[model samples]
Target chain A: MTASDDFAWEPLDDVDDLEVGDRRELSLASGKLVLVMRTETGLHASCADCPHQDTPLAEGMLDGSVLTCPLHFWQWDVTTGEPLGVAELPLEIFELKQEDGRWWIGMRR
Target chain B: MIEVTVEDRAGGRTRFAARPGERLLHAGLAAGLGLPYECATGTCGSCRATVTEGDVGSLWADAPGRRVCRRPGEILMCQSAAAGGALSLKLPTAFRDRREPECRSLSGRLSSFRRFTAEIGTFSVELDEPVEHLPGQFALISAPGVEGPRAYSMTGNPSTEPRLDFLARLSGPGKLTPRLFSNALEGREVEVFGPLGRAALRPEDDRPFVAIAGGSGVAGMLSIVEAALARGHFDRHPSRLVFGLRSMEGSYLLDRLSEFVRLSGGLFRTTVAFSDEAPDPEFEAIFPDLEFTTGYVHDVVRSGLSSISADRPICFVAGPPPMVDATMRMLVVEGKVSPAEIRFDRFG
Candidate 1:
């Protein structure tokens, strides 16, 4: 709704309820699910399921900057998608931008 | 004898020989290959790998860990064995070569038993060979006629005694717990694979500690506390523990906890949290060292989390699935504790 908004930034819905240390799975138009978490550093988004066993990361616990899967307790830094101890795979993280008082999520540049 | 070949995603290949009836996971581990695993009793599915060449025999046909095998040839290494001749498998992760064997088979027999409550009891297993173990580790014990191994935390200090002791609670509907309470189980030979798990008590760390447990999960907590007390760790650092139970009738091991408190000279504190009922006056008079509270175990842990010293205390937790999950959430989210500092075997 604004001029010079030519970037393909997809508007994110249900972001108003995202609080610090909270995550929710969002259904994308592409039928892909992405888990969005708000930490002290701001908003972060990653693949909804864990790479190890495909457990839903939305059901996991996020402590500060790390997200721990409930099933096996595999941990990762949600902000950077870096695998933590006992985690063999890195998470695919999407970039989130809050611009013009609105939130958007897209592929990492 | 069977030949097993393993290939990992990191372009690493290794060949090893496995004795007949030996599990693939155990064989690899005993050979000093660092295969990633948790809850090695055909649970957690951390050792899922693909069979690219030959078929492997299934020990437990209905292992719950099979739920994680989605790919065409994926199988839980812990539950599979070399059926015959040669077998080739591939893992999705890299292998780290380690020096010490992660676990070894121990043929043990039921030596003694002591009842703590109607459903809870303590049993001792005398292994044919002595195996040194760290505190807070658990074993995967398979009894005769039991379809598969069940994980139990070792309650006895293995350093002092060669035999292993386990606290058993006969929760409704179990594969092996009912047999643990039977008098016929005495002298029964069983299979044990253990001294596994990483949440061990390191007395040298010299940091304050906290333990939260529910039901029979106190088995590991007791091991850690006893080990810490033996090394005089409590004299240098303060520690906290909370054990959860349904009511006074379900409670046991208070005498040992009381003894631990008395030996600590008040440095180590324990609180018993009852979910169903508060302790009566008569019960309260029995152990003056224990503090009794009425609430869920997770809340009890939360109430004391803020009071713990800020010098980075390692937290140990164990329980039924729901209690462990809820308590972990409380520690990481509400208590602001790091996930790295909290340790427990999922048994999931």
Candidate 2:
């Protein structure tokens, strides 16, 4: 594993607990972040607060790969971390993986 | 010099210097900081920030954004100036780690003034240099002698040249419109600062577009539609535009809208909704290709929601606050559309 002082791989929760197209807020030791969407494609994670105006992303609307910020309607591609129309910046994406039927997130040190 | 320290929610800090009598938002943006703002003229509360440990002064104390700032330390960054010493503040939003188009001040001259009605007019500004702005973006224009600048959306397509078109609606006498409409004001120099506003059309958006505008609010929509047509967006995805007016006399831009519809080759749909009066026979005769309905604009949109697909659809709404609010509520609550799917610019 590549060593980095900024990030670490931390187990989040059981993969079976999260349903497809549903997002859950996970409180890790590092900080509060949102585990956005388990689709047939894969799992993804991003900051809980929106990059625009700091609205909670947990309150945002998620449709498949697109996550829409509730505050300003700024849309993001959850998988690629690309901002869509009206969104100026991409959402910070965390590395996510599944092992032993449990999900893990890359948390910033 | 005033030292402004802004702390974001994620604990990121940005320090900048602000000159005396400079708006905090302006100074921050000039320094290439991603400060939150929407109507830099003190209308929208998007730029509200909290002063943690310093005194701040206001250029416009009674700004509309004040009503939305409920917290004790909260102040509209657009209206607030650092009065003295080092100022520490907290932002609800954080600056992103990305490159953004540089926004700067531009000088221009007013030309091509044509009155559409007693309450409405269309005009053009010839800039000293061409500006790059997205469709649905707006510019802030200040008349030579005016005390404050007003935000006006650029009408028609985004231009690569120095010329820009605008639609102006007279709220009443004794404002910027009077000065602009004056006969002697032609060819007068004006100061412009912008390429502002985020409710814009992106080239990458492939979803069907629905535009809802009221009166002068249609200004930005015209630019959006024009850009959409140029991109052949209508050819792939359908577009529906609904414009609302009080009566036929107050109506303008029907011919331009008709032209857009004709160019879309049956892919674009448009409707004119009149709130107070029924459609006149003579008005229908002029634009035979357009559809006319009698009702409030939001109601027309609500009634027609069934025909529009919700899958990845992008909707834009602009108008007076009440109309925009009503339309937003209908789209969110009644229509069950995701709030993210709807975009709006509310003029109070």
Candidate 3:
């Protein structure tokens, strides 16, 4: 197995803490940053910064699964980091897993 | 109901459902057919096409694209829909992507609004997110409680973040600004779509630069000046900015412009021309280094360019349709500058 795959699932936070249509900012133990969001379906995580402007994505407005940048209003698919129409940059997404009723995000490093 | 036949450049014929009240560009864009357009409203003239058959009606009959219309049947597709049935149309087969920067809708709170003149106001929007845009770009702002979107140029420097500056003119009777003039509350949420415009400042060779502006036309010029200062263009090539206004009160961007002059350090010079009123003494005192003139902006630019003809300069004009048209005529026909070298954008 690869080193990225070898790391065991480490609990980050309780799923009940973040409500639907809300986002919480947190720093990982590995020093990598992530934005955890609770959508209608469940939980999703991505890089804190917007790929286009380096502004924090948590600062944007959330409409369901879409997050719109407040700076220039560029939007992205929060779950997959896929850019919407007229959005030039794609977001950075991370894998999320649930273990023992807690949520955790998979980090490459 | 007018039956207009839409045809591709390859002479393929397809019937499109068009109405007399709708515009041709709207119908074409809504039909999912890729048509060439920028500023899909009437101003850019990118949607111009030749009418192969039938009678059509154009709302703006005297559109400037009529100049490029050689045959009698040519019409602006954006301004005209279909007046009668069985209409035929043709478009260019291949289109080049002008690839203007991408734009999206952003929400902002009005940080401040101040009147600079009786007909103009300078306002800033503090966005929760900082939108990225190239210099000399514009945004479509939808004021809260307003029905439609209004396009305004970004006067703020691209290097700055968190807030954007816009100068809006109170022309005739409009929806948003009139409400704003009556005192719109600060911190109110406003929707904006933007960073739209192609009037970029690119300096070639070492020829002097000529910039002409009237009223809020300074938006694009401000972006150009910022770009120039960032690239040290003034140090390498001299620049002359000619600004025109109806009266002394109409000149609102003077302070910001004065800072540009200070940065250029004798390499850049600004000329202020007043049309309806004589040059104000206070303006002269404040802008001691600037040249003052009494006349229309286009005429002032004509005289300035005429005197500096030996310099072989490239001219840029931005303003209302009349000002842009008048200045283009003076530059191309009177000043003898090649049409390819002169550039202008009508903000109307």
Candidate 4:
């Protein structure tokens, strides 16, 4: 199925390679970046840079769905990209889906 | 005069005046605006703002914080000054409602100085007026002829007396260190602005306190311990202090640590971690009360993480970037401590 025109599906990684409770950083050809997290429920993606001070969210501590930035301890929810704790801005969420046992990120179409 | 309008994410706006050649962060803080900032120096990208109108000039163009600015108009408020008549900037978040202590400019004279190690010196300044501050707050001090102010954490607890103490590691005969270490600096007047930084120990907190310091980073930890002791905090909550230094020859403040441990009656335990050497027999004899470990400070803390209760104990970490980063990572990733519980300041 074709995604909305606002997004284009871009291959990220194979579903088998990412274990549950794992996060990986991915960069797009357009220079857009996303941090992908695999949970028991599904795969979630958000902006790689933290909303607080631009710390790489890939380096953040992920406990369940909560992702904590390493720089100043700002946190965000990986599932919904909602700000948590001292974090004031929500992480920009990106659409992700699994196709043929491979994960793909939704980029701007 | 430059008119600065800072708009927070909540749609609230604060208008303040910025004097020429003054940092935007300093001007806003002096105007009583709760602008976000940590390490008013050119590090820790907490003070970043996006300029929607007018141009901004940076005193430290190559500030480390600049790397965090992902957009074209972003600037570090601590390093940027107004270069135009009017400027409008936007913050990514709302200003915190907590009232910040008033910031002001004060004059002080170097009252005392002593060499703690061959490269480290401890100094005291007697301000013209007493400045109130929390346990781990620091002051920005500019020497008579120094180009810019350097932030130094107060090594002693706040008191009614106008005297403040600091510990600094001399990088060499450089800008401010030479003047600070010089014998003639005693009685020389200097400019001090602050009582800045948010990592502090409050008197009402009951949780156990854990502090990790490296080299001169011990300055703020010393103040934290003093304040905690004054409030009888150690008597109720077990506290741990881990200090990392290169070797015994470069280590100072062991005597003070021993005295604090003795005063705590075994509640406050301290470990002096030597990265380069094991504790010598003579050194062990001299500091029988203090624990000696051989490793990086973060490694020492990691090894003993099981002993520390995870019931929301507040951790204060100060050191070089790598040490602070490693300790913070260990606490959050391995020890399962919340990031909110770890407090620290980063400098350029």
Candidate 5:
């Protein structure tokens, strides 16, 4: 399938008040950061960068609520973004939201 | 370098020049000889051969292949380089057509790089050549930024030429897969050495065939099913494919597998086991023909096939070390499938 080109922005009310199962993306020092709550889809998200070989997490699999590396099936839990089920190391999950239809993410603050 | 002569069971001998430090299987392959091997790094015992004459020594004492070598003269071709000169070895000698398939350096552009699950991607390489590989066999793939060559079994049948399909898993310490998919761009060239590996579907064995696979290992088993359907092997005996994954989403071949029931007129059956999650009803709705269970893969296989007392059936298994080892142990210890009938294709 071809990649999606359409972009949709949703606004979220509060960042700290966000409950489980909510996801948002915000800009940070590095770049655009994505934050996903583990309970929503029962999947974990990390830097989208494969830690072992630097593959994107976008190409991986999620099983047992764990995010498996698409390249080798190394796995991590989506809820905590902590590596689990197999392999080692945790994935970085950014805090995010949709504010007034605009996707806003939390940086360090 | 040590030179040796390999003799087939029929007394046909082929001379091979072995490298001093290279694994015997590597040397044989380099000498343009087809040597039986699965995980050429010494995990699978497919490369086991008997030393008919001369001395042989293993490079690694703790090599896992050592477990399958029983005969006084048996040694692992992947682990044992020739220690002395003028060696005579007896090939495992199966009834495979001696005309080995041509191996080509296939260059391709990676396309359709999408994640099948969290850790696996179902990708295809549009190859420059038409490569034919039997089910249960694999190809040696080389991609940019990945160290050395890594092997992956073809999920598509040999009939699909010029476009080879494969499923790759991303894990820490795994080679190549992560680098290839990460920062992906279109029109990048990837090299492939293919149509290699010997484990394949056996049309002659009329007994019920059993396939047990774990994770991406389902790639070859799925190909085996396709081959069986093409060759009418399923008409004679019902094929049972037992696949194990951590979740329903982690399993990639279920789309094709769903048609097994109708395609084989209910003769072919597929059972999937998830290690982590319970069966999803939606998944069952999509593939009503398949059976879903929550447990280890082998446990499901053992329970599901217990009633059938058929003998001399063909069993094909591929996966990680622990899963493969567990299945092999159960098949040997409980199922009592003869060693000759049990096939393994583990890379680790």
Candidate 6:
């Protein structure tokens, strides 16, 4: 409602206690899994599955701003969704914002 | 025999012939096409390909790697056999050229067996034909009473004597290792298919390096260290190894690693990180050159990378999957090292 009809922001009420270097997977209304994490920089959102394979990114390791898949050690920049290390594909990213200390993630409606 | 054709990401194709029940992955690799694989024994799922034409049959229906083969036509190339007259598959890799000394199948004899701990042991495979493999490669060992082949990294390189050394941790009774450690079975014939794994140490990789290992995972790191010592590479660079064990009771390769530290003239150093117990004073006296610390391997490396002399040192890591993951995160995230500088193979 804050933006246009093409984009809708959903309240992520479960991530109230997420700390730096912590990641959690959230189930969307469309049955898609979204990965939410807090890095040293800020909170970021991406598809919970690695783009190389469907390995859950919530089980992966987050170092600073980089996210690494535990399966094959393929890495990506959490903020830019750009491929790093052995990854050949970019991660699917979503816009995450905070208001009044709470978080809301924007998805294509 | 039927034609087995493999297509890569760039649409380049390579063809080889395989028999009805032969693994097309082995055929492609033996034919000198760099078919991608890690543990060639139905694990890691790196050799997965889509069957675009003809057909293939699964040799192992319950392979754990099958988790990756979700599509109807997708198959694990290492666990599948040719079933039809002509077969075609597509790989996700851009055609990786086969490096020198492509793998082949051969028979070897067990010799020079010895035990370090009650559950851990080592021996040499005296091959009928000498296999020249790079440091850090592994081979699959299949003995008569064992269910299937188990992969073990080469702890030492092939010498003029035509022997390859390996270490094995016991998996309990009725397992492959109980026999491997219980006897000195020289001239015991066994099947070996390898020179597999991509963590091989290359002279061109880096002068300064850091090797971290846990438990029996030190075998591969030991091979790399020996190679560096043999080729005089240890003389020029300041490299370090931090090996993790539960306690001094689980330690192995003390003589060799300690000697490497002593001979390197301060260029190479080793730290034994004990997770379960504090550094023992008795061991401190025995290994004067080695530094002992009380911490996990990842945590130990984070606190101190002793003798590491370069900002961009190549890193070699091994152990269980969880250990490798934790260490990799620390290296790339906190240490600011690029992933391109790290080399390792995934294993169960």
Q: Residue-wise lDDT of candidate 2 within B235-319, one digit each (tens)?
A: 8998889999999887888999999999999689899999999998888989987999899999999997776545547889998
Q: Per model, how much of the real contact set is kept? A: 0.33, 0.14, 0.00, 0.67, 0.00, 0.43
TM-score of each: 0.87, 0.74, 0.58, 0.92, 0.60, 0.88
Q: Give the Cα-based TM-score of candidate 2 against the true structure.
A: 0.74
Q: If chain B of candidate 6 is superposed on the true chain B, what is its TM-score?
A: 0.93
Cα DockQ of the candidate 6 complex: 0.43
Residue-level lDDT tens digits of model 6 in A4-73: 4566878777887899989999987667689998988888899999755578988888888888887777
Choose 1 or 2, whichever is better by lDDT: 1
Which has the better TM-score: candidate 3, or candidate 4?
A: 4
Q: In candidate 4, what are the lDDT values of residues A1-109, reduced to their tens digit?
A: 6546678878785335667889888777667878888777778888988777778888878877888887778877788888876778888888876778777788765
lDDT of candidate 2 at residue B170, scale 0 to 100: 74
Model 1: how far residue B20 lies from native, Å: 3.6
lDDT of 4 at B253: 90
Clashing residue pairs in candidate 2 (N, C-alpha, C atoms within 3 angstroms): none
lDDT, model 2, position A30: 63
**Which prediction has more favorable DockQ, 4 or 5?**
4
Better of 3 and 5 by TM-score: 5
Each candidate's DockQ score against the native complex?
0.37, 0.10, 0.01, 0.61, 0.01, 0.43
Model 2 ranges with Cα > 4 A deviation: A1-109, B70-72, B96-100, B172-174, B309-311
TM-score leaderboard ranking: 4, 6, 1, 2, 5, 3
DockQ of structure 5: 0.01
- lDDT, candidate 6, B291-341, per-residue tens: 899989999898854323235778898887778888887776677676777
Residues B1-348, model 1: lDDT tens digits: 798999987778998889878889989887767876778877678789999998788997788878888879999999998888899999877785453325788898986788889988989888887777778888888888877777788986656455898888777446787877876688999988877777678545678888888888889889999988888888888898898999998789999999999999999999999999988989989999999999889999887777643556888888887898898878776776666688775544
User: Judged by lDDT, which candidate is best?
Assistant: 4
